[model samples]
Structure formats: structure tokens, C-alpha cells
Target chain A: MEKATEELIKETAKDIFFKQGNLHATTQDIADAAGVNRSLLNYYFRSRDLLFEQVYNEAVQSKRSQLDEALDADLPFREKVERFIDVYLRDMRKYPFKEAFLISEINHKDFVLKNKKKSAKLISFLDEIAAEMKKGTIRTMDPMHFLVNLFSMLSYPIIMSPLYQQLFNLSHTRYENFIDERKDIILQSIFI
Target chain B: MEKATEELIKETAKDIFFKQGNLHATTQDIADAAGVNRSLLNYYFRSRDLLFEQVYNEAVQSKRSQLDEALDADLPFREKVERFIDVYLRDMRKYPFKEAFLISEINHKDFVLKNKKKSAKLISFLDEIAAEMKKGTIRTMDPMHFLVNLFSMLSYPIIMSPLYQQLFNLSHTRYENFIDERKDIILQSIFI
Candidate 1:
């Protein structure tokens, strides 16, 4: 019951913070939404900032985990890159605010600077991929460039949805199909 | 003289908004930074939001102009794609906040949705390229996918700078070199 309640608080806080942003959201709002007293939120998470950090970190790690698994699988590097894109895109859909939350945080000077765990796990995974690419298991390209491009192609639609809708006259109603249609286009763009 | 001051104010306001965000920045902050009085800011732009809108619109227009130029050039579709990447990257460096500002505004859902001049220009250009691609002047891939990937490869670095740094353990000191090196790798990613 304790774990369940804690999980409930976290899910509610995550939704509120994502929709309202960090500064705009209040602890009481999270507590009320979670169906818990304000003190329980602090008791479980310590503070709102700490709670948000947990959520953001988990979201980033979740996506990283998916990517790491794909990279670690017994597949050729070319196939890995293809599969990585698929996995990354699928993971991104699960966390719609992930891009926006990340973008807002990244503007700060030390936003992700202190998170050694995330940094290490991701870099090690990248290094392994880079090593394979170096051996020509993948086509010749800078691993970093491939990494950046792969993510951008995968994440750009969600991050830049406003620009797309604005420029293309696409309505909010069309967003689902628009994004679905663009997936193949985005993939082809990178691997064509 | 008036045009230059208007330009200066817009530049200053954009820098402030892009770096500090909407909540922390004040109109006086923009005015003082631009070496003008608050009244002058109001006289010229009416309000902070208006000033921001002007800069945002101009930033979009400038990027679109470069894209249209490269895409509409008489070069073949493949060459156009390469040139588009080069020109877009070069121009983006001049306005680092373009992506961030746009993303934030998009998140807020505060901006008016209207047809961008660039949209018409770009759609026509892409349609023409699609025609050529259909004729086998370029390899077979959906045009929209080609576009999504091309932009992702080119723009993802700026858009996701924080995530990139954290995930890869990259230092800000090496950012320029990192992006410069990626150009070739990104180009190859598309071709292969």
C-alpha cells in the first residue's frame, strides 16, 4: 500500500509538472491531485524540486534504457542503428513532454551537469556503438553525428510540432496522422 | 536611424527572452539592455510580448529565406539537399535562440497560428523536388521523410544541445568542433 501510494503521488506529480512546468506548479496542486496531504508529498519526495528531478531523471533514463538495450542486443551496427531509431521513436511517444521538459531545462547552465549516472550510462553505450562504427560494422560516419541525427529525426516532430502545424496549416486534430506519416519520412531521411 | 533602433531593440529583447525566458525577463530589462528607456520600448513595440513576436517572426523568416534559396537553386535535388543543410546550419549559428524561442512559445500555446510565408515558399519548392525525385533524379524516398531527416540531422544539435551534452558527456568548450565534424557524417547517413 505504501509503494502503491508513492507511485500514485509520483504519477500525479509527473502529469501536473509536465503540463504546468516547474515554476507554475505548486506543491499543493500536486498533493491535491495525488489525493494526498501536502506533507506526504514532502515526506515521500522531500520537495517539489526534488520530485520533479526524480521524474525528469526517470523519463530520460527510461528512454536511455530502451536505447541501451537495443545497442546491447546481438545485432550488426547497421541493424542496430535502424533498430535504435525505432526504439527511440517508440520511447519518445510514451513521454510526450520529454522533449519540452528537456529543452526548458537544458537552457540552464548546470541543468544536467551533476547527473553523473545518466551521463556515464549514455556515454558508455555511445562509446560501444562508436567502437563498432569504427570497425566498419556500420557505415563510415562520425558516431556523434549519427547519434545526433538519429535522435533529431526521432524527436524533432514532437519538439517542433508547433512549427510544423503553424507552417503547414495543420490543425491540432491532424497531429496524430501527421506524426505517424512523418516517421517513415524521418527514417528514410537519415538512412536513404 | 529609426530602423536601426528598432532592430537594436528587437535584438536585445530576443537575447533576453531566449536566454532568461518569459517569466524572469522584464520590459525594463530589455530597454536598459538595449540602451533605451522603457518608454521608447513601448513607443516602438507596445509591449514585451509584441517585441518578442517581431523577433520570432523575423527569425523564422530569415531561416526560411535561406532554405528557400538553397532549395530553389537550379542545382539537382541531391545537390540542393546538401546545400540546404550547409546554408541552414550556417544561418542557424547566427541565431542560436531560434529553436529554443520557438519551442518555448509552442509549449505555451500563446502564439497565434497563421500561415507562414516560408510555408508557401517551401511547399512549392519541396513539391518541385518531389517531382524530380519521382523522375529518379534522386534516390527513391518520400520527400517529406527526406526533409524530416535532413532537418533533424542539421538542426538536432542546436535543438537538443543539453541532452546531447548530458548523454555524451560533451563539454561546451568543444561544441563548435563537435557540430562541424557532424556535417559529413550526417550527409553520409542520408545517402546510405
Candidate 2:
């Protein structure tokens, strides 16, 4: 029952946040949305800020870990890049508001910073890619720059979905199709 | 004097919203920070949400129009991409919090459904790009995918600077250097 309530809170809060944003969303709002007592909101998470952080951390960390694992796997760089794109798009679809929420929170004073470390293995994997660039196995470029652009091209769309959906009149199906085609586009943009 | 006061209000509101997420910020707080009467805020802008939309529209439209004009200029695709990166980085440096704030606003329900028609020109540009892609002059890729990744890599660092600064232990000088090199990196990532 504890696990169930926790799950309920997560679902309710996520829905409320994406709909209303963090500022307008009250604890009572979350409690009412979750069909639980307002006190239970505090019981599960001490404050709205804390609750926001919990969701933010969970939403962000899950993607980070998966992408890290994909990058760290003993695969060719090209294969790894493809896997990274897949993992990123899949994750983006799952957590549509995570990018915007986290970006907004980055500048929040009430947002007490959390120690969400990047996986060491991912960093080392990135270093290896840099080494390959230096050795001319991959194109000559800064790995940091490459990584930033690569992920940005893939991830920015989802974060900007509300904007893009407006601009392109993209249906949900078409938007997913757009995401599906990014791996080739990104690779050709880089490895060529 | 009216212009100066309006500018002050905008500047103050930007700082507060940047420092605290929109939920925690109030019009009263913004008015106080600007050293103006609370009534002045509404007098000038009608409401907090409308005032924020003005700020966001200015922020996005400013960079966007400049970039759009550049894209229309008779430059090679590679040079245009480089110019886009340079211009984007420069604007991002000038208005560090603008994109995050705009993105946050875009996610809110009040704006999302209401403002769909206001974004047609931005979508048209992407459509034009996709049309170009079909002619095989540029590499084949979904325009939306290309767009998402490119913007994410280029823009995410700025929007999420506090996180990156902490995690990377990036000094101001180092961050500037990273941005300086980003134009070439972006060109390389996009150009075959």
C-alpha cells in the first residue's frame, strides 16, 4: 500500500507539473489529484520542493543511467552512438517534461542542488571517444562539442515538443517518426 | 521615465524568475524588487503571465529573426550553419536565462493551447529545410530530428549552465572557451 501510494503520488504529480508547472502546483493540488490526504503528500515528500526534486531526480537519473550504460558497453563507436540516440529518444518520449522542468529548476533558488553525479563509466567512455578523435579513427573534433551537438539534436525536439508541435503541426505519430530517424542524421552529420 | 521604469520592471522580473522558478515568484515580489508600486506591474502589463509572455516572446523572437534573416542570406550551407552557431552562442551569452524561461512558459497549459497559431513562421522555416533535404543537396535526414539534436547540443548547456558548471567544475574562462569552439564543432556535427 505504501508502494502503491508512492506510485500514485508520482503519477499525479507528474501530470500536474506538466500541465500547470511547479509554481502553480500546490501540495493540496497534488494530494487531491492523487486521491490521498494532504498530509500524505508531506509524509511521502517533506515539501513540494522536495517532491519536485524527487520526480526530477527519478526522471533525469533513469535516462542518464541508461545512456551511460549504452555508451559504456563494449561496442563500436558508431554502434554506441546509435544506441545512445535510441536510448535518448525512448527516454524523451517517456519523460516529456523532464528536460524543461530540470532546465527551469537549474536556475531556481529554492531548488537546493542535488548531487546527481554523471556516471564515471560514461565519462571514461567519453574520454575514450576523445582519444579516438585524436588518433583520427573518428573525425577530428572535440568530443565534448560532438557529444553536446549530438544529444542536442536528438533531445531538444522533445523538450521543445510543445513548440514544435505548434510549428510543424506534427501529430504524435509523426513526431515519433521524426525521432526515429535521428540516428542516421546525427551519424552522417558527424562521422562523414 | 516610463520606458526606464518598464525596463526596470522587466529586468527585475527576469532576475527573480531566473533565481526562483515561476511558481515561487509573485507579482508582489517582482514589484518590490523593482522598487515600484505593486499596481504599476499590472498597470504596465496587466498580469504576471502576460508580462512573462512578453519577455519570452522578445527573447525567442529576437534571436530567431536574426537567425532567420541569416539563413535567407546567400551563404553556403556550411557557412550558414557556422554563422547560426556563432550568433546563437553570442545571444545565449547575452541573455543567459531567456531560453529556460521561455521553455518553462511553453510547458504551461495556459499558453500551450492558446498560442498555437502564433508560431507559424517558425514552423515554415523547418518545412523549407525539409523541402531542401529532399533535393539531396544536403544529407538526407528528418528535419525535425536534425533540429532537435542540433538545438539540444547547442542550447542545452546554456539553459542548464548551473548544472554543467557544478558538474564539470567549469570556470568562467573555461566555459567561454568551450562556447568559442562550439561554432566549428556544430558545423562539423551538421556538415558532411
Candidate 3:
């Protein structure tokens, strides 16, 4: 029961911070969201900053693990990218503000990744991208730019959805449909 | 001198919020950054919210005008894109956190754009993109996706610089060079 309560609190905090885009949500807010007494929350986490740090670390780890899984998957290059987009967009739909939260934390808190070295998976993924380029399947450029371009298209529209919905005059349903259409569009844009 | 101080406070707030990515900066922080007393800041803007409103409005206005200039320029489609990239990147280099700030405000504050309608300029630009597709100069996709892809490639790298610098193990100078190289790369990715 105690473990469940603690997990509830952490999950509630993630919902507030990641799903709702409320970077300024207070401990009281989390406690309210979790239906727990403020003292109980404090008892479990000690303080708001500690709670936030745990959530932040978990968010980073989850994202890194997702990337690693996609990169290390033994699939064709195109299929690998398709799998990556599927996983990434699934997470984005569930937690639209997560990337925004991550970026904000990095900007405001001087957050540093614990694993500073580039992962072997990522290095191999770059090599795979380079190999694909050699086959003239994708545009020839620095492998890093290919990665950047892939992530940029996949993440940016979702991150800026609030603003883009207004700018493009898209209803919520319409905007979602537009994003749904992007899977193929993105694939086509990359390949030839 | 009075006008100068007021301008100084606004500019300093912009520097803090847009350049430094300190979205949570207090009025006292802004005043300190401006080298002005809190009372002086209040004297000019009446309240911190009012000061923020002014800065936010100006940032939106400035970005809109820049886009308008690029879209409405008489240059060829390719040159116009090149010019847009140049201007957008130049502003981004100066105010790296501006888009993050804007998106956060929209998400957290229920900030509706003053101009909610799709601009005539943006519509024409979309038309222009469609025309380019017909001419076989670019990949065929929803014009909206085209715009999203363009802005994504342009902005995401800069916005995620703090995180990306660590993730990719890029030195500050090397990252800047990477971004500098993106203009040509973005053009190539867009134009067939």
C-alpha cells in the first residue's frame, strides 16, 4: 500500500509536469492531483525539488532507453526509422509536453545528462545512416544532420502544437489528423 | 533618460526570458538585470505581468513581421527560402529561448494570439509551396507539413542546444559550427 501511494504520487507529478506542460506546478499541486495529504507527500519525497529531480531523471532515462531500443533494433534502416517514429509519436501523443518539459529543465536548471558519452548504439545508428546514404537511398549529408533532421520533424510540430494549432487554424481533431498523416510524409521526405 | 530606463527594463526582460531562458525570472531579477530598482520597473510597467505582456506582444509582433517580410519578398522561391532561413536563424541565434518561451506561454497561460486568423501572407506562402510541388522543385506533401518541416529543421537544433550539446558531446564552438552548416543542408533537404 505504501509503495502504491508513492508510485501514485510520482505518476501524478509526471502527469502534471509532462502531460500538462506545467513546469511551475507546486508540491501542493502534485499532492492535490494525487489525492494525498501534503505531509504524506513530503514524507515520501522529502521535498519538492527532490521529487522533481527524480521525475526529471526518470523522464531522461525513459527517453534515452526509447532511443536506444530503436537504434539497437535489428531491422532494415527504413523499418528501423518507422519503428522509431511509431514509438516516439506514441509517447508524444500520451505526453505532448514532455519534450518541452525536458528542454525547459535543461535550460532553467543546468541539468546535465548523467551519461555524457555518446552511446555505442547511437554511433552505430550514425554509421547505419551513413551506409544508407552510400546506397543513395537517402540524401547524402553529415550523418549528424540526418539524425537532427529526423528528430526535428518528428518532435517539433508536436512540441509547438498549441501555437501551430492557432497559427494554422486547425481544430484539435484536424491537427491530430495532420500529425497522423506525417508518418508517411516524413518517410517520403527522407527516402529520395 | 526616463524613456531610456523603460526601454532598458524591457530589453533586459527580453534578454532574461528569451535569451537566457529564465522563464521564471522574478520582477526583482529583471530589475537587477536592468540595473534599475524594483520601484522603477513598476513605475514604467505598473506590474510584472504588464511588463511581461508588453515583451510577449513585441516578440510575437517581431516574429510575425519577419515572416511577413520573407513570405512577401519578390525573390524567386528558392532565394526567398534562403532569405527566410537567414533571417529566422539570425533571430534564433540572438534569442535562442524565444520559441520555448512562446510555446510555454501558450501552453501554461492560455495565451491566445492577438491575430488568430491565418495570415494572407502565410496562405500565399502555402500556395507558393504547392506551386513549387507542381513544378517538381520540392517533395509533394501538405503545404502545412512543408512549413512544419522547415521550421522544425530550423528551430529544433537551436532550442535543444543545451541538451544536444551534452547528448552529442559537442563543444560549444563545434555546435555553433554545426548549426551554421544547417542553412545549406536545410535547403538541400527541402529542394529536390
Candidate 4:
């Protein structure tokens, strides 16, 4: 029962922060959202800051693992990218504000990644991108820029959806459909 | 003297919120940063929320004008894009957190943009991108995606610099140099 309650509180906090984009949510807010008393919430997490730290660390770990899973898969480079985009977009659709929340935490709170071991998977993926360039399958540039470009296209539109919807005069439903259409557009843009 | 003091408070708030990424800054924080007394700061802005609203509105206005200037220029489409990237990158280098701040304000604060007039300039720019696609100068896709891709490539790296610096194992100076080298790479990626 205790473990279940703890998980419930944490998940509720994540829902508020990642899905709702409420970076300023308080302990009481989490407690209220979770249908628990504030004292019980405190008993589980001790403090709001401590709860946020756990959530932040878990978010980073989950993202790294998602990248690792996609990059380490045994598939052709293009197929790997396609699968990665599918997985990433699905996740973003569920938690559209997760990236924005993570960015804000890092920017405003001086949060630093605790793990520093350079991912062998990411390095190998860069090499793969470079080899694809050599074969003229993709544009030749710094591999880092290639990765940056890929993620920029995938994540930026979702992160800035609110602003773009207004700027483009798109209704919410139309804007969502537009984003749903970008998977192919992104692939064609990347692979010449 | 009074007008100058008011302007100083607003600018100081902008510096703290946009440049420093200190979204939680209090009115006292702004006053101290401006090297003025709290009462003087309040005398001009009345309250922190009011001050933030003024700053936020001005930021949005400035960004719109910047886009209008770039998109309305008489240069060819490619050169116009080049100029937009250059202007945007220069602004981002100076205020790296501005976009992040704006997104956060919109997401968390229920802030609606006061202006609703569809930009004729941006509409025409989209038409230009479509024309370029017909001319085989760029990839053929939804022109909105073209703009999204362009802005995404331009803005995401800067906004997520802290995370990228860690992920790529780059020193600050090296990372900055890498970003500076991306203008040509972005152009190449888009122009085929």
C-alpha cells in the first residue's frame, strides 16, 4: 500500500509537470491532484524540491535510454531513424510538454546532469551518420549538426506548438494534424 | 529622469528574465540588479506582474518585427533565409534564453498574445518557399513545415545549449564555435 501510494504521488507529479506544463506546481497541488493529504505527500517525498529532483533525474534517464534503445537497434540507418522518430513522437504526444519542462528546469534551476559517461551508442551512431554521408545518402556536415538537425525538426514544433498555432492561425485540432504529417516531411528533408 | 528610471527597470527585468533565465526573479531582484531602490522600481512598474506583462508584450512585439523585417526584405528567397538565420543567431547568442522564457510564460501563465492579425508578410514568405520548391531550389513540402524546419534548426540548439553541451561533452568555448559554424551547414541542409 505504501509503495503504491508513493508511485501514485510521483506519477501525479509527472502528469502535472510533464503533461500539464506546470513547473510551479506546489506540494499541495500535487497532493490535491493525487487525492492524497498534504502530510501524506510529505511523508512520501519529504519536500517539494526533493520530489522534483527525483522526477528530473528520472526524465533524463528515460530520455537517454530511449535514445540508446533506438540507436543500438540492429537495423539499417534509415530504418533506425524511422523507428526512433515513431517512438519519440509517440512519447511526445503523450507528454507534449516534457521537453519544455526539462529545459526550463535546467535553465532556471542550475540543474546538472549527474551522469557524465559519454554514451558509446551515441558515438557509434555519429559514425554511422558519417558513413551514410560518405555514401551520399545524407548531407555531409559535422555529425553533431546532423543529430541536432534531426532532433530540432522532431522536437521544436511540438515544444513551440502553442506559439506556432497562433502564429499560423491554426486551430488546435488542425495544428495537431499538421504535426502528425511531419514525420515524412522530416525524413525527406534529412535524406537527399 | 522618471522615464529613464522606468526604462531602466524594464531593461533590467528583461536582462534577468531573458538573458539570465531567471524566471522566478522577484521585484526586489530586479531592483537590486538595476542598482535602484525597491520603491523606485515599484514606483515605475507598480508590481512585478505588471512589469512582467510589459516586458513580455515588448518581447513578442520585438520578435514579430524581427520576423517581418527578415521576411519582407527584397532579397531572393535563399538570401532572405540566410539573412534571417544570421539575424536570429545573433539575437540568440545575446539572449539565449529568450525563446525558452517566452515558451514557459505561455505554457505556464495562460498568456495569450494580444495581436491576432495574420501576418501578410509571413504568408507571402510561405508562397516564396513554395515557389522555390517549384524551382527545384528546395525540397517540396508544406511551406509551414519548411518554416518550422528552418526555425527549428535555428532555435532549438541555442535554447537547449546547456543540455547539448553536456550530452556532446563540449567545453563552452568549443560548443560556441560549433554553433557559429552551423550557419553554412543549415543553408546546405535546406538548399540541397
In model 4, where do residues sit more than 4 Å from their true spots?
A113-115, B113-115
Residue range A1-192, candidate 4, lDDT tens digits: 489999999999999888877777788888999999999877987887888888988888888898899998999999999998998888888787787777778766455665475699999999999999999999899999999998889988998887898899998899999999989999999998
Residue pairs of candidate 2 with colliding backbone atoms: A23-B23, A148-B153, A152-B149, A152-B152, A152-B153, A153-B148, A153-B149, A153-B150, A154-B149
Q: What is the TM-score of chain B in candidate 2?
A: 0.74
Better of 1 and 3 by TM-score: 3
Q: Please write out the lDDT profile of model 3 over residues A7-101, one tens digit for every residue.
A: 99999999987887877777888899999899987898898879878998898888999999888889999999999999988888888888778
Q: Ranking by TM-score, best first? A: 3, 4, 2, 1
Instruction: Summarize candidate 1's per-residue lDDT along A1-192 as a digit string, tens digits.
Output: 388888998888667545433424568877888788999988888887788788878766676678668777677656766677677766565555566665665554345356444445456667766787667555555557766766777787766776766655667778667677755665455443
lDDT by residue (tens digit), candidate 4, B1-192: 578889988999888888877767778888999999999866787777788789988888888898998888899888899999988988888887787778778866465665475699999888999999999999899999999998999998988887788889888899899899879989998997
Which residue pairs collide in model 1, if any? A185-B145
- Predicted structure 2, TM vs. truth: 0.83
* Candidate 2 chain B: worst-modelled 10 consecutive residues by lDDT: B112-121
Which docking category, incorrect, acceptable, medium or high, applies to candidate 2? acceptable
Residue B181 in candidate 1, Cα distance off native in Å: 2.5
TM-score of chain B of each: 0.81, 0.74, 0.96, 0.95
Put the candidates in DockQ order, highest first: 3, 4, 2, 1
- In model 2, the Cα lDDT at residue B57 comes to 73
Candidate 4 chain A, poorest ten consecutive residues by summed lDDT: A109-118
lDDT of 3 at A127: 95
For all predicted structures, in order, the TM-scores are: 0.78, 0.83, 0.97, 0.96
